[model samples]
Target: MSNLPTPAEIIAKANAELNQAYRALGDARDWLLSDWDVQPTAEQAATIRRMREAIGTAKDAINEGRP
Candidate 1:
């Protein structure tokens, strides 16, 4: 077994992982906002905002081929 991955294979894997992470963050943000008042801490809102910005930045990188 080898530890190294081909460039194409690495790119494919990274893209898939990034897409999944972005989707999960979006889902979490949606869930938080839908029931924001139930939370007793500001952490959830802060986290959702940060995740939204991160997703936007990730999408931009993917689109710009800078990732």
Candidate 2:
């Protein structure tokens, strides 16, 4: 018998991967914001804000479009 994954299994795997990516982004965000004793410089703060927005956009896309 064939052992190939079914469509549902493939989709489940993809969703799991996407969740992992989202988690990694969160971890990076936490590290950038809290892992250091010193505050980020203005440029660094701006970049972090951009990164946060991007993560929020990704979350919205995942919530709105995921199967």
Candidate 3:
């Protein structure tokens, strides 16, 4: 058993991690909207906004070289 990852394995792991992060952003957005009436703290609002922006940037990078 070696500790090194093959190129394919590394790519797969990176893709999976990006997918999970995207999904988490979606979940956070949904929760924020659904619970807006509860008046989330300013810190919570800022955190959600940051998460959404980070996800957008990641998506942009992924799409950059595509046609």
Candidate 4:
């Protein structure tokens, strides 16, 4: 029979996912910041910054194994 993952293993998986999410969010922000014919509005830029911050918060929680 296959052994189930322990709590530590589960947290590790969640942390990996959170790290990926953070990276993806950062990539999006970078793309937004890149030069383009049309640029994001002030509000749009602010929203992207907020989204990145939220992703950072999630990464922190996952590292801490918060419920």
lDDT of 3 by residue, 1-67 (tens): 9899998888888877767766776677676557455776899879878877876786676556332
Candidate 4: global Cα-lDDT? 0.74
- 1-67, model 1: which lDDT tens digit per residue? 9889999899888878877776776676566557444664588668777877876676666666535
Which residue pairs in candidate 1 collide? Answer: none
lDDT of each: 0.71, 0.81, 0.71, 0.74
Off by over 4 Å in 2: 1-3
What is the lDDT, from 0 to 100, of the residue 8 in candidate 1?
A: 88
Which of candidates 2 and 4 is the stronger one according to lDDT?
2
TM per candidate comes to 0.51, 0.73, 0.54, 0.56
The full ranking of all candidates by lDDT, starting with the best, is 2, 4, 3, 1
Which 10 successive residues of model 2 have the least lDDT summed? 28-37
Top-TM-score candidate index? 2
Give the clash count for each candidate.
Answer: 0, 0, 0, 0
lDDT of 2 by residue, 11-46 (tens): 999888888877887787676667667878999889
Ten-residue region with minimum lDDT total, candidate 1: 32-41
Sort by TM-score, top down from the best: 2, 4, 3, 1
Q: Which residue pairs show collisions in model 3? A: none
Local error of candidate 1 at residue 4 (angstroms):
3.6
